[model samples]
Target: MTSVVEHDTSDQFSPATSPAPEATSEPAGRDGDGRAARSRVPALRTFLATAALVACAAAGGTYVVTQRLADAAFVSLEDAVLTADALPVGSTGAGVVTEVLVTEQARVAAGQELARVRLAEDPAQATRGPRTETLKAPMPGTVSRIDIAVGGVAGAGEPIITMYDHTELSFEAKATEEQLRDLRLGMAARVTGPGLGRPVSATLDHVKPRVGADPLLDAPLTEEQKVAHERLTVVLVPGTGDVDAVSALVPGLRYTAEVDTRTAVGRIPAVNSAG
Candidate 1:
């Protein structure tokens, strides 16, 4: 009877123990699971470090390429100026700059209109109103100056186009009279000096005498009234085919003009006005 009573008491307590608070507890999930958190830290650190290294490598490559490009080949100039002067395109009539056909520093083709002039001043008596046509370039060249602005009135004979001559320019290099005989009117020469290079394929245009010797070249040249001159001027034709390639040798690019006296430069048809 005693054993039976003890067994019955144990069975009744089992139901309460199954639903106790101690039955469910998760400390690892709540208190920052140690192994899981630590493993993620190493992976995040590796990703950040890899990204930094990749960025640094890209920057280094860019630096090397830029430096090499700067050191590469190109022509250099010194103390050069445009040979041509401000050329007038409009007729001798007072007019307003009505239309701007081109922009400053713009490249113009042969026979391209640069601007349109409309006569602002009326004549007391006229056979016909002032003749107007869009000003066109006689030869291909760059616009060096824009003297008149839009709506600005210009007097008679005012220059409309300050067209720098784009045709083959004769480079006037002063060399000794001894060099004059050495250079024939049609002989080939190399012209390279302080402001020229590669002997810009040159021809002895005509060994003309200069008015006076360069004072800088000869200090005593300025002292004499009857200035003694002994210098040969040269005309050069570019070897490049087109105006674009020729433009690479921009105006006022003073290079070392090396004269290859033996090499003869061919005459361009455009220079003779046949083209």
Candidate 2:
């Protein structure tokens, strides 16, 4: 309790001379544990994003494939109309139809007499040269039309008998500009005529460039145009044998044709144009 000693004022200790250490802890992302925790969030996000992207791509691919499957495919037609124009027995000149022997729908043999063209001269046209009429056979087919009458004048090469081998015909299918590519000279074909619902196997005889030539093929477009009105015609001959199928096929029967399709066989997918 007794004595007090006073120190010099200039010798006092200042707060700056004894500064305290900074109080800092490790930051959230500084250590390996912190870094690992942070990395997990981004990895999860990436997985979710990738899954979503894959799903979207799969949907798009499916849509494209479905659309292509529904596109139009190539079809082969075989149904056709059986028709024939009877041809004259001979290459005889023009003559008068003196004796008409065969009637319409009359079945005639190969050498049966069809009509007798008269050589008798007309009293009015006696000044003209002598007429030479001769006997002719009806085309060896069931007579369908009898256009000429007795004593009627017949022109040269006139179709008195319309004859065609429709029992079984070989069609030379004409191709359109679109279906003209990649076709072999003897590609397989399928045919189906009227009265037959089934498809018949056939061969592609040939693909004619043009449907047919009018009187003016070599001439310019003005005289005649061979513009295709419908799908190009493809000729197909039925597979060998079995005349019974064609025997029932009456002439003038409407038939459908398939160049390479047989309904008996399943419908084929169209070839991809991309490849």
Candidate 1: tens digits of C-alpha lDDT, residues 15-96: 7656656644578565567777898999999999999999988899889887765433211222222244446666457888
Error at 186, model 1, angstroms: 3.3
CA lDDT of each candidate? 0.55, 0.54
The TM-score between candidate 2 and the true structure equals 0.48
Best by TM-score: 2
Which 10-residue span in candidate 2 carries the lowest summed lDDT?
A: 266-275
Native-to-model Cα distance after best TM-score fit, residue 91 in candidate 2, in Å? 8.0
Off by over 4 Å in 1: 1-87, 125-133, 190-200, 209-221, 224-229, 240-244, 261-275
State the lDDT of candidate 2 residue by residue for 1-275, as single tens digits: 88989886543576656668786566633786877988899999999999999999999999888766533233434345444444544225576776767776565676677766655455788899666555555435566666677767767666555444435555444444456443333455555655676766665544333335453536555422445432355555566763446545666555555443322232222221111
